[model samples]
Target: MGIFIRILGAFVLLSATYNPTRWNFTRWAEANWGTQMPLTLLFGLLLGVGYLIYIGATLRSIGAFGIVLVAAIVGALVWVLIDYQILTLQNPSVNLWLGIIAL
Candidate 1:
């Protein structure tokens, strides 16, 4: 349960910050900057803090080498999925799938 929650949190944070859709924080901030500067800054800082916490925990748990290894594994998995016709690179949702796999 804890692991699932952590993954969910990371996914939410990542997608909320920047995604293919225009409903994310970056898009929101860009569209409302002039009228909502203060709120924008506040949310930006909050997001920054959330990133710091997650990044710190990830580094502390796995270190840089582990991160690289994990990335390599993920890359290989994606390749295998493509090779096996399980995942199609041309699909629009592949981006979202990749993002989810990152968690």
Candidate 2:
């Protein structure tokens, strides 16, 4: 169940990336069908909330140190992938700057 929630959350996060409309209700509704907008928002929110809850539960089962280790590993993997251009460096310097700020 926890694994399922994490996968669902990842999917939602990916979808949200494509639909910048999520942050703007009027633009979203105008661009997409009203029914679709509501459904998308509901699913995205549910996935996001479920993912965080499940990750917290799973991390608790592991331990605090495990969470830190996992985060570091994932961060390193993202950096490597981006550096290698295996993952499109969308905004290039801007993205690197943003990443620095995020840390």
Q: Compose the digit string of candidate 2's lDDT tens values, residues 1-103.
A: 9777766665554444343334543345456766597776775576668657757776778788887887798789888877888767565655544443332
Q: List the residue pairs that clash in candidate 2.
A: none
Ten-residue segment with the worst summed lDDT in candidate 1? 92-101
TM-scores for every predicted model: 0.82, 0.42
Q: Looking at candidate 1, what is the lDDT of residue 67? A: 91
Q: Provide the global lDDT of candidate 2 against the true structure.
A: 0.61
**TM-score of candidate 2 versus the correct structure, residues matched by position:** 0.42
Cα-based lDDT for every prediction: 0.88, 0.61
Off by over 4 Å in 2: 9-52, 91-103
lDDT (10s digit) by residue, model 1, range 1-103: 9999998899999889987888899999999999999999999999999999999999999999999999899889878887898877677666675756576
Candidate whose TM-score is highest? 1
Model 1 CA lDDT for position 4: 91
Q: What is the lDDT of residue 25 in candidate 1?
A: 98
Cα-lDDT of candidate 1: 0.88
